[model samples]
Target: MSRQTNKLTATAVKSAKPTDKPVKMADGGGLYLEVRASGGKYWRMKYRFAGKEKLLAIGTYPEISLADARKAREKAKERLSEGVDPSMAKQLERKLGQQVAANTFQLVAQEWLERVHQHDVVPDHYQRNRRRLERDAFPVLGKRPLSEISAAELLACLRRIEDRGHVETAHRVKALCGQVFRYGISTGRAERDPTPDLRGALRPHRSQHFAALTEPSAVAELLRAIDGYGGQPVTIAALQIAPMVFTRPGELRQARWSDIDLDNALWSFTASKTDQPLLVPLPSQAVAILRDLYGLTGRSEYVFPGARSHKRPMSNVAIKAALDRMGFKGQMTAHGFRAMARTILAERLGYPPEYIEQQLAHAVRDSNGRAYNRTQFLEQRREMLQRWADYLDELRQAHPSSSQSSAQ
Candidate 1:
């Protein structure tokens, strides 16, 4: 628009009428009220950048009044003087506004949960982290802006978890918070990961070893008790095979029909902790227990299908509940079976440590940093496991109250 063209007024902008072609009501200085052919009114600014003409939207009319449009136009002129494109400036401003809108700790944390936590970790690990965040972190810092969350505030949040004697959980949650904040920084939502500032702030967590029976006599008692356990057949079968295979309770409970090769007397599964394939050389006693169970659950996907839902595996809680009923709550956990087998395999059976580790399916890596093969000690493990089962039978027979029940 030239100086000679009359400036548009608020009344002219309000009553602007549409026509077959769009009309521009000049407000001078390259600003105009655009009346489109479809009866839409817009505020458009015409400018030149890098020798090309461009249109920038200041805002729609009625929301951006005449005074506001003039101010916006003045701001655009200043940017032009600075050799910056006004249109590019508007786009950047919108992007920054969106960044500001989504920089809240809760939103960023939720994003981290989906993109990093759940994607990288196992499902059970993700669930535990999710629950901790909901119960501990979300209540304190969820809605706050990531920029405003200080180290002190987060330490206070973690200290609350420690006060409740959840020392390890507190440490874990702190590590998770660090992961979330670092993700926010990487994604341009936060400035810093405040967790590093909290170094040595939380108390160290002491790990308690799982209580297990390493003594031959104690093992005899546990085996005898399993024989007399008045529980479901599935439960009884699981108890019977535990001493022979000594698999992690979760892995044993989640065993599937396809994972078992009864003809070859081998039970295969992927280890949950290390995410590696495992092959447990089933002894004759263990194979007998599984063969008996096949008559009950061979049609289902899970060898030990849930009582309530055959589609799913048996509940870990139910297995633990059975342990509680057998007077082994704190004295012995289901995981204790692994420790018992690990000790006796090395101490009594005199198996090589490498062979024992292989049978335990530990995450042992070779010199090339490749994981040891799943069947590395297959033959040795097959021999060792059978001897362990026979030794357990001998211990049961040596006991004072040996019922001499069949391996059926």
Candidate 2:
């Protein structure tokens, strides 16, 4: 019932057309050469398996000769006899290839970010994590497969950051790698996390504290030096308010005009360190200085707009430079104002530590065991700020010679 012919040659296959039709290969048993309208020749096998006729492609002509095509066709027949579908087997191969590709670190990291975003990771947290990936991890192992990442490679990546004097950042990078690796493991893309062995690997860092002027006389000298500052009005006002308010240099420099209320005598700003909105009750002197600066820079949004760029605020270094110019480089920094206020307000003025702490916006436990509010110690803070300002003025007027002569 089968039409058998002599072995098909390349010329015969090329000259054949759909009209000429296909001929069964004498060597192939049931396999035949198919000639199409496009003059393309293909080898196909026709067989009965499980009471059904099935056709399977061996390969094209020339590339796979008649003999080789028949050999492939015979192998497929053997698989079919075992109840295996060749089409499904090919599909499984393709799926395995895709799985291998998706197991790459770059692919897994992208998938991790997608999953994290869907779970509502806060924007700040997302930004921080993304920065770590871009700065610390991506350059080395981004394109590598997750399973290819060994413990040595991970330790090397973290050590690069450690070499830059950021032990804390190196530790954080190790943590992020662990997170990404765990994500890979959960998705069956990676077999093991490489960061667990990195504990105690980094060198210890020396602890350093900010230099602060704590003595009242030294603080008074620093204030007098700031008062005599011949800098720009914004810089001078920032220096003036730095000791009075004792806020962090960053918070003071980034203060916006909209955050200040001259009429209510309040300087309200979102504290950068705590990420909380704070209401600082301005004393009469602080209010007067703000009024003068407001009239000068009221049109701009920032209280201390940069000289070169109005859109940006003054730099924190500018305040420190002002202190350096006054020859107090090592003795006081812009942050020293907080120490000055804490010392003078608590010891010299005999103000309640709670009231002074609240004024400083330092974290404190309330009477109800709850956190302090933005308006905590409102009345007491108002009184304390005024008293602190008056005390500074009293110190400014008191002279050593006059006080000694009066005592005599």
**Best candidate, TM-score:** 1
In model 1, the Cα lDDT at residue 401 comes to 47
Angstrom error of the Cα, residue 402, model 2: value is 8.8
Model 1 scores a TM of 0.76
Q: Candidate 2 — which residues are off by over 4 angstroms?
A: 1-135, 141-154, 168-199, 367-369, 400-408
Of the candidates shown, which would achieve the greatest lDDT relative to the real structure?
1
Q: What is the C-alpha RMSD of each candidate to the true structure, in Å?
A: 5.3, 7.1
| lDDT, each prediction | 0.84, 0.76
State the lDDT of candidate 2 residue by residue for 66-130, as single tens digits.
66776776677677888887656657878988887878776787688778633444334566777
In candidate 2 the C-alpha lDDT for residue 279 amounts to 87
**Candidate 1 lDDT over residue span 167-250, tens digit each:** 999999999899888988898778899999999999999997877777777777778888999988888888888878888788
